[model samples]
Each structure stands twice: as C-alpha cells, then as structure tokens.
Target chain A: MLGEVEVEVYAEVKPTESEVKVKRAVLNIIELDELEVIDVNGVKYIHGKARGLSYLSRIRDLIRRERIRDTARDLLNHSVVGDEVVINVNKQAAYVGVLSFAMGEVESPLGPITIRIKSSNPQQLIMWLTSG
Target chain B: MLGEVEVEVYAEVKPTESEVKVKRAVLNIIELDELEVIDVNGVKYIHGKARGLSYLSRIRDLIRRERIRDTARDLLNHSVVGDEVVINVNKQAAYVGVLSFAMGEVESPLGPITIRIKSSNPQQLIMWLTSG
Candidate 1:
C-alpha cells in the first residue's frame, strides 16, 4: 500500500497595512490598499488605510446601491442631514464642518480638504475630541 | 531507525463581526469583540465595532503614552483647533460635531450622543457623508 501525503496550502497575501494617524489618533484598516476596489457579495466599495499612528485602522467603501433605493422606499421623503464634525490637519489647526453625506475615498486628506457633505474620522474624531 | 510523527495545530478563534451602518457607511474590525480589552506588544487599548454599513475598517487606539509626551514637547504651545464637520444619527437629524479628542469605549451609540472633545467614526462618518 502507498503512504498518504499531506500538505498545507497557503493563500497569497501580504496583509496590507491600512492605517493612519490624524494628529495623535491611530486607525487601522485591515486587508486594504491604495485604490483597491472590492465587492463583498453584492456590495461594492474600496479600501484604504490611516496614516501617522500605527494603532488606528479604518475603511471607506460605497454602500450597496440596492440599499440606497431601499432606504429611499423605507423612508421616503426622509431629508438626509449632516453631523457637526471638526478636523485638524498637520498642525494647520482644526476646522469645523458637517458630514452631510459619504463617499468612499481610498486616499487621505480625504477628498481635497473641504467637502459638502459627510466625512470620515468620526470615531477617531470623537475619540480625540472627547479625550481631554 | 525510529519513525517520526507530526501533528497539526489550531486555535480558538472566530472572525469578529465588527461592522456598522453610519447612514450607509461600512467598516470592519478584524478579530474584535464588544468591549474586548486588548494588548499588542507593549501597547494597551480597547477594541470596537462600527455600526452602519460593512466595507470600512478603521481603528481608534490611544497612542502610546510616551508618544503623547513627545508630541507635546515637539510642538509646545501649539494651539489645537477644530475641523468643520457634520453628522446624523438615527432620526435625530444631522448635527455638526468636532472630533477634538478621543476616548475609546467598547460600546456604540458612542457615549451619551453629544460630546466635548474627540470622537470616533471618521472613515465611516466620511463614507456615508460622501456617498451621494
């Protein structure tokens, strides 16, 4: 009789470091990269990393399009609003803005500084803002 | 000659479900559990999962204590300001909030709702706010 041989197969991956440090807060984004478009089942979006601190990980991806339409139906006439948020950029001081909407940007300084609606870094922002 | 034997190893681990639906934002925190305290290397901090959409993976860990002291010395008397930001929670409507400081909590609804300094949910906050 022949002896059976066993082997382990490992997937090819480098465990991307999607992390960032805005001011003093650290964020981590697992399995992300610069401009990597991804789709989870039927959802589509992109991945990104936080810079600066090595403890913060975050992600920015587009929601499933179907969900948008569903939300519209479930809450028709629902007027979307914005949240008051503040940001500080590389010693440039902090500026106040409103996160009216969201757009997944695989880049940092996320979308040319000032945006009309929505923003990233809320968890990070609140963490920093609340931490005395 | 003596025969040799080998054994396989396994661990007690299940992929964590750290996701959120901030408007339409998505974030993933690998290997995280609600209110699970963690310590990697010499760093110690808490872990949290986002609420909203799934596609964003962001982290909010306090920088090493020594780093904070270093930054203070590096930029003495540097006035820390705020960034113009916005937010919308449930049906409470949108309200602009500045993430001036950060305090990690293993719980969501992140604190009593409103805060003074620091906040969480940037990548998520941004993803939803921008996805028009």
Candidate 2:
C-alpha cells in the first residue's frame, strides 16, 4: 500500500529473547469503537482510547484564549497527535497472546518518538508485530 | 539573584527597527496569581498563566489510565512545562506599553523549540528587553 506504515514492536513485559527479529514491519492505525474485531494473517490487533491529541487541542484552545503560554509546542512542531489507532502488527512468525500493553519508538534525525499503546492483549500485539 | 534566568526577547509584531538590542537580558518567571503586579526599572514585564506542563501532566495521566498511546515521549524527553510565568524583560533604554501577546522560541540541538507567551503587554516586553 502507498501509505502503509511500519512499526517497531515491544511486548507488555520485557522479552528475555528476541521473539520476532526482522527489519521494519507493516503497521496500521484502526479505530475499534465497536467490540467486534477480526484477527487475520497472524496480525494481532490492540485497542485503546486516545487522549494525546485531545490534550494538545486543549492547549491550543488555551493559546487561543490566552489562558496560558504554549511551551511544549515550541519543542514539538510539525508533529501531530494521533487518535485511537489499531496496530496491525504484520510480522511473520509472530505469537498469539493477550496484549495488556504495547508501544513503539520511531527514530528521527532530530530525535526518537515513542508511541505507547494500552491494550487488553499486549502479548498478542507483541507476537503479531515480532513474528513477521 | 540565585535562581534568576536570562531570556532573549522579541517584539509583539515583527520589529523592523530593533527596539531593544542586546545579546542576553536578565529574565524572571513570576507567578501572577493575583491581578496586581508592580513594574520597576527599565525591565518591562509580561503576564500570563502557564499551560505547557499542565498539558504534559494530562498526557501522563492518560498513560497511567491507558487512555491513549504514548507517542511523543520518545522525542523531546526530559523536558518540563512551566506554570504561569511573568517575563520581566530587563534591558536598558526600554519602553512601556500594553502587550497584546508575547511568545518566544528556544533553539535546542535537537531542533528549534518555540515557547509562546500570551501577554497583554507584548510591546512593553520587547521594549524592556531591547533597551538595555
């Protein structure tokens, strides 16, 4: 896919050994407002409500209102806060387990950006992302 | 003063003619919980409540609550958000005026970080910082 994204995966608990060791893996940000979700291609999915962007937006409103100074915006510019996302960790040889937590870090030239995901099945998320 | 800080100043609107030119000027971050504030010396002061740290703290709570993914933590790590700060732009040959809004940008090795201050006395701030 032209806009398909790749994500680096981590487990709920630190992994003793490398579960899935590969380069970049296919990643997806999906919304799961409903309780129903489909798991395919060993691609594990995680669900959670997003609050980062909301916080940022609140700050933006404050700026517009002149309620407070915008200090953080100075450091993180041209960056966006993502809403609820479903991580479709498409990695081969991944595992299938419940995921309680999941997160990833992106390394940019300026710095590294870490994305933390809270899920009921973090283990499964790690397995899916690590396998392929 | 032990904890006194220095700030680089800018004008409310772009200044074609450097109103107050100086390398670095003494700065103060005072809390104006009360409406009353005193002006002293050529140092002009700007007032506004702080919201940057509050926003970050909200995100931290989200992390604890598992409401959203922690993506920004990877970048701009170990930074802090300040509460309400009063900028006492201390410089010689300063002017006095009402500040509509005042914001500042800090340059860091990772990138250029801009801290925006909303003040009712921006022109005064610029004048105060530039004079000395």
Candidate 3:
C-alpha cells in the first residue's frame, strides 16, 4: 500500500512542439490535481503534481493490459533510489495512451515523460505498481 | 525575375506532435495558397501548394536578414536537379520565425520542413533568391 506518496510529472515542450500536446501526453499516463506551464531560460516545460497513488491507475492498467508486468517490475526496481521511484516513459507512446518505458532520452525523440514518486515506502509502492 | 513556379511544402505530424504546430511551422516559412492534411497509412502529413515565386519571399528575406546568403546560395545550387529546387529547413527554427537550412532529418528532431520549387529556369530563381 502506498502511503503519503507525492507524484510529479514533467515533460518539455520542444520549440517545434505544441504545449497542449505535451500536456496531453502526460495526462494520458497520470491524473494530476495541479498542472502548470513553466518557463526556464526561454525553454518551456509542463509540470504537474498529484497526491496519492490513485493518480497512477492509468499506467498500472496499461502495464497489465500490455502484459509488461515483468518489464515494469524490473524498471521500477531499478528506478528506486532512496525514497523515490523515478521512471521515464515514451512521450509519443503516451500521447496515444500507451505506457512504454523508455531507458533514456534516445528512445523518445521529443524526450521522455519523467514521473517521480516520493513515498514513505518506495519498495512497497513499486511492488504494488508492477504487481498483477 | 522568377517566372511561373510551383511550390510544395510538407511536414510530418509525429504521433507526439500536434498537426496545427506542424502547419504553423510550414506557414512560418512559405505562404501556401492551398494546404491539406493527408494520411499515408496511419501517419499524417501537412502538405501545402502554391504558385509563383512570391511565396518564397519570407525565406529570401530571412536569408538576407540572417546573412546566410553564401550558405543559401551554395545549398540552393546543390539542391537544383533539372528544373526542380529542393531544400530542407529546420522546423524548430521556422516555428520561431527564423530561416535556418537543414541538411537532412538529423537537423530537426521532428523532421525538417521540406520546400520544393519547380520552375522553368531553376538557376534564375536561385540567383534571384540569394542575390541582394
């Protein structure tokens, strides 16, 4: 069970990309209670935050539907550090409502959607997310 | 003076990319009299067509403003084949209203905006476009 978990999603809006589409890509994976567009040194980013693990239901559903539980479990285990579980998913895939994990920036040309979850018990959260 | 010329512009709308932004990137460089979105299989492309050399005025002006005449002249000359002149411009740059030439797809992550011009006298058109 996830306890006192805080989820943060972030995606960059490339100069050639529309901000709306980028936000849609993020929303397709997680439901954020608060979302905002922030600019840093002329570059724009879509940032969103939500409380609790319920926001990640869409991703859990996709992983089960795609039958990528093993892959997701491995990725989630590797992503765990300290009290955070950070994972990157393919933005293009997410745009079309698919949850494809990306190893790095190369996998997604527009860059990956970064999801960071801070929980009191990271291992338990990862176990729940990748569990069937 | 460029005689009757036909211009065609195209940009792909990647799964993660917005079609409207792709169209805007094309329009930022050349003025198209007719524009359409076509789907080849499941992939979508923004295609536009126009007549006369006036459609290329913005590119010419940008080349002059950016002081890339020599580079443009060289690129234009190399792009000539028979009566057709083909050039690729950085889509990100175009979106920002700048005219930066791209050699190939590598230059633009979303793919470059392709501009093709067919004229009876390609050399003359190239001369006028690059000349002060």
Candidate 4:
C-alpha cells in the first residue's frame, strides 16, 4: 500500500456505441491527477498533474491493446469507486499478480509519470480499452 | 464491496491558511459524481447525479465535524489514489468498525443519496473535519 501517496488515474469517460465504437469512447477519457502527496502534517495542497496531449495519444494504443485486463478485472470484480486498491511495488512483495497497474508513461516536470485507471466497470473498460 | 457500481466522491479543494483556514478549505470542495452505472454488458452511458445545491451545504456540517474520521484514517493510512477500497455494507456485515462510511444524506432523482470522500490525506481531512 502506497499510503499517503498520489497517482494519476485515467478512464474512458464515454462508452462506445458499438464494440467498434470503443475507439471513440477511448477518446473521451477524463483524467484527474491534480492532487500532490507531500507529508500529511499541516497544509494540504492540491494541483493537477502536468501531462500533455501527445502522451494521451500515445497511451491510446496501450489502452486499445488491453494490457491492463488482469488489473482491471481485479478492481472491477472486487471494488467500487471510493474503495482503495493498494499495489505494493517494493521488495517485501505485499501483493501478487499484477505488480504494475499504471498506464503508459507520460512526461512531467516530476520526470516521466504513469497513471492508474479508475472506473465503475473497470473490467468493461478493459473491453473498451482492448476492443478496437 | 459495491462491485459494478458507481458512487460520488467529494473532497475539499483548498487547504486552510490556518487551522481556521480549514473552514474555508471545506467550502471549496469539488465533487465528481457525473457517472451512471448500468449493466456493463453493452452501451456505456455516463451522467451526473442531479443533486441540488441545498444538499451540498447540508453536508458541509458533516465535513466540518469529522464524522468520517475512522473511515478516512483507514483509507489514508492504507491506500493510494488509484487503488480501490472495497467497502461492504449489508446484513452480512463483512467489514466492521464503521458500518457507514458515507458522509451524509442528499436528495437525488434516484432518491436520497450519499457520498464518500477521497483525498490524498483522507486522515488529515478527518482532522479538519473534526477541527474547530
């Protein structure tokens, strides 16, 4: 669990009219990565991550391929919107299966950044992500 | 776990300049509940909950008083933004301690509604919620 941490999340905002329409749906994705995770002692700060247009386009291909299906299925079948799914990446190996739930890399002032996808039907979005 | 379901999440947008500032921060809360969860077999659709302005003010007291500290602590100390925190509520009572993680009641066309709060330091917000 990355307690007191922040990560970018992306989900296709609109659903495709058809299985074929999933591509269009993928275009309407909304990302909310604007909160930072500095020490949680005093002042709480919030800001959006500085990701660019080219990165969004680049990730479209990754989403289209369904690389995150296992992780999506885990989230969809087990949790809801407000629920937290902790992914541990260090040596202790807290959880198994998918070590990386993050989406494609994007450039940021913090250096390269990645995002996790949060959705109502994360599994269904996997279909949309991999569909067309 | 409310799998295959959608729920609204709210969090204060700004931090208070002082301990007194938390009140002002509480006023700048942002909500993103514009999503609907129909069966995930086909045609995905998205829409916002038609909650009214009165309800937002109504919940402000709940946020101010820190009614959700236990739940927020559970989240802040354990999960990250992208992780899903599955909360089970029902006759079975799979998860205990705080049975109601929801903030407060609000009217919606779907009937009365409730929201969960998501933030970088959900625990600290709990402090603000209970502070002054």
Candidate 5:
C-alpha cells in the first residue's frame, strides 16, 4: 500500500525570465502546497513542496494524454533510488501545458523543471502513476 | 553632437527566473525610465524603455571599468545599422553587475539581454560611448 508521498519541484529562473511565468510553468505540471522563489548562491530558483500523491494527478494525466506510459514507466523505474524518484521536464513545454522529458540538464536552453518524489512505497507509486 | 538617444532593453523571462533579478541585471548595465513585463506569444519578456545618453552612462562606465573600450567600440561599429546600434549582453553576468558581450543568441543557455539604441548621430554616440 502507498502510505504517503512527498514532492519537491525546482526550476532555475534565468536572469531574463519572469518569476510569475516560471511559477505558472511549475503549477501547470503539479500542484504544490508551498511555492516560492529562493536564491541559491547567486542564482534564483523556483522552489515548490507538497505532500500526497494527489498533487501529481496532472502529471499522471499528462503521461496518459501524451501516450508516453512506456517511456515514463522506464524513466521512473530507472530513477527510483531507494524511496525516491526524480523526473525532469522541459520548462518551455510545461509552460504551454505539455510535458516533455528532459534527458539531461542541457536538453533545454532554459534548463528543466526538476521534480522529485519520495514515497513509502516507490514501486507502488510508479505503478499507480503509469498504470491504466 | 549625439543629440538624443532612445534605448530599449529586452530580456526573456524563463519559467525558472525571477523578474526582480532580471530587472537588476538590466539596471546594472543601463538606467531605464520605464520597465515592465509583457507576454508575447505566451512567452514572458522584460521590456524597458529610456531616452537620452544619460541612461547609457552605466554601460559607458562598465566599458571603461572592464577596459573593453576597443572591443566595445568594434562591436558598436559592427552593430550599427542606419541610426540604431544593437548590443547583446550575457544576462547572468549583468545580474552580478558585470558586462559580458554575447556574441550570439546561443552564447548563453538562458539567452541574452538585447539592447537597442537609436541616436540622431550614431557616429557621435559611438565615439562618446567608447572614447575617453
């Protein structure tokens, strides 16, 4: 049984970018209980935190709509390290309400929206996310 | 005489960036009379407008401080098209109050801060900007 889920999302705001739009891009993918902009060193980042699998409903729907269940499942499977799974999506694509997997940090010129999920049962969480 | 100068500063706000920092980046290089964020084709951009050479005082100072007068002059010379001179600077560097020229749009992963300046006397403007 999946007991509890914790999620964290981060996106770097380039000096040329708007905080409001970056927030929208993150919200477009997943709902967060807390969201704010924080400066790490000299770089500004959009940080989001939430608890429970309910917040990931939009991401689950996106995978289904985009017909990437197999790809997403593989990605999630490989990303699982103990109790956590990490996913990166293109920020530009997310802003337009689309989910595009970023294979690496350099996949997008503006960087990716990094999503981290921790669950009591990561296997079950992955099953629930990718399963029809 | 340079007469009058019109300057427009623009930077794209990526989803992960803070508007305040981006504004700081632009202000670090030049002063603007009006600055705001506007949505263009669903993309957010920092738009700035100013008039007169006084607004460009910071940029001129930066050129002298960085000792890039020769290089800056060459860039300004090449960028001159009609009555306008265009320059692109790395936004990240600008945020930290440093002026680094962007050779191309792809020079920075987050894109560059594009500056457009129109002057009644482009030759005089260039000389005033680069000359000691």
Candidate 6:
C-alpha cells in the first residue's frame, strides 16, 4: 500500500526492459554492498545495513526529480560520456548520470556481495511483502 | 555464512574508501527499477523483482570478476571516459565496465521504494538476517 502512505507519496515511474539490463550491469560492475529491494502494497525498498534514512533515499529523490533512468538508457545506446551530457532517448524513461561531487580515492571490495536486486522479482516480492 | 553456499563465491573482494561514491553515483545517475541487497554474515545481495534467482545475481558475479569500483572512483576522481582506457590510481582496486553486450538500456522507485539501502545500514541488516 505504497499509495496509502500518508507521506508526500514520492515514487519514480517504472522502467523499461533495456534500462533494466544496463542497471543490472552497473551493479555487477561496481557496487560493493548489495541492497535488498522489497515491495509491499506497491512500495519498494532497498534493504541496507546502515542506520538513518538509508543513503539511497537521497539518491532516489534526485533520480525522480532529474529523471536519470531515461538519460542512462540514452547514454547506453549512444555511448556518451562527458561532464554534462544531455541524453535523448525514446519514451523518456527518466534517469540521470550524476557527476559525483565528492572526492577521495576509493579501493575495491574485500569480496563480491552475496546478493543484489535491480528490479522487482515477482516471487521474492510476493514473499517479502506477504511474509512480513 | 555466504562462503558455505559455494558457487565460486564470486563476491568482489569488498569495496574500499572512495569507490563506493562513484558506483553509488552510477546507481543514482542512470539505473532504474530498484534492486535489493541482502547480506548474510557478509555476502551482499541485490534483490530483483524478476525470476530465475534474480538478474542482479548475474551482475554481482561480474562485479567480483571485474574491479569496477576502483575504476569508478578513478573516474569520479579524475573523470575519465573513452571507448577503451586504463584507470590508474593509488592502490590496486578491481573493476571493469562492459560496454554492453546488448542494445537498449536501464534501474528506480516504483513510487520511490519505501525501503532503500545503499551501504551497510546496520539495524535493518540485523533485522533482515535475524528475522530470516
């Protein structure tokens, strides 16, 4: 019942098939810690080990406002990498490739993560929401 | 715990200092359809809403195989991009970016998933693991 949430009700629109493929790749290629995505009554979630409002909530807001998903698909299709590139793709999937404003050199992972979720898996989603 | 699963434990050696930044950037930048990451004793995971053990599991195996996190940080640090190039930095971080074996693209909030975790958020991780 994501819709039932009394909050402002912020949710990004669903993504397309191709976009899914690219994101899956990004996670595969990079991300160290794996996050869990659980959906209940339509509300999706990324399980984390930290406290506070989870860092991703901040990222998600930016994604929705900037429409980064669609932009990513465009970059994927055309293969564009620049400081500020405006990707033009069909069907406006809404995405953004943020130029990290942070600093410091990062190393790699101690080992790969055990699990990763990039989209909604029907069975797991059902299990996650219903089990709880 | 994850080690016992046996399957090559393809887990990336684990991420360090700054690379998490760039990879997190990539996630915020262009991916759609949120993924879940569940860590059991330390195996991070990304949960998908699809079937067949989830698509992101494929991505994780890749993350470990390649050292994209180190590369992402270097990119985030020096901001480099090309058809093919080298990402040299302080230490040896493992990461690789596959241009894309398929066409089209994407990852996001169905309605801004109620739960989103980027790193080890702590409590939730405990809840997730203990509950299971």
Candidate that would win on TM-score:
3
Error of 4 at B69 (Å): 3.8
lDDT tens per residue, model 4, B7-118? 3432211111121222222222323434343333432222233333332332334444546655645544453344232221210111111122332221111111224334
Alpha-carbon deviation at A128 in model 4, angstroms: 49
Please tell me which predicted candidate would have the highest lDDT against the true structure. 5
Model 6 alpha-carbon miss at residue B96, Å: 22
Which of the two candidates, 3 or 5, achieves a greater lDDT against the reference? 5
Model 1: runs farther than 4 Å from truth? A1-68, A73-76, A80-132, B1-132
Q: Mark the 10 consecutive residues where model 3 chain A has the least summed lDDT.
A: A103-112
CAPRI grade of model 4: incorrect
lDDT of 6 by residue, A27-87 (tens): 3322325444546575333223332222234433443445554553333333222311112
lDDT of 2 by residue, A47-79 (tens): 223422222232233233432233322322212
Candidate 3 local lDDT, A3-112, one digit each (tens): 79899988988876778788888988997876799998988889998887799888888888899999898889999878999999999899999999988656776778
DockQ values for all predictions?
0.01, 0.02, 0.59, 0.01, 0.38, 0.02
TM-score of 4: 0.20
Task: List clashing residue pairs in candidate 5.
Answer: A12-B16, A13-B16, A13-B17, A16-B12, A16-B13, A17-B13, A17-B14, A18-B13, A22-B15
What would the TM-scores of all predictions be?
A: 0.15, 0.16, 0.88, 0.20, 0.72, 0.16
lDDT of 3 by residue, B37-110 (tens): 99989888899988887898988888888899998998899999788999988888888888988876557767
TM-score pick, better of 1 and 3:
3
| Fnat of all models, as shown | 0.00, 0.03, 0.77, 0.00, 0.62, 0.00
Candidate 5 at residue A126, lDDT? 92
TM-score, cand. 1: 0.15
What shift in Å separates residue B3 of candidate 5 from its native position after superposition?
Answer: 5.6
Alpha-carbon runs more than 4 Å astray in model 6: A2-55, A72-132, B1-132
Interface RMSD to the true structure, each candidate: 15.6, 23.6, 1.7, 20.5, 3.2, 15.4
Which 10-residue span in candidate 1 chain B carries the lowest summed lDDT? B8-17
- Candidate achieving the largest DockQ: 3
Residue B126 CA error for candidate 1 (Å)?
44
Chain A TM-score for each of the predictions:
0.20, 0.20, 0.95, 0.27, 0.95, 0.21
What is candidate 6's TM-score against the reference?
0.16
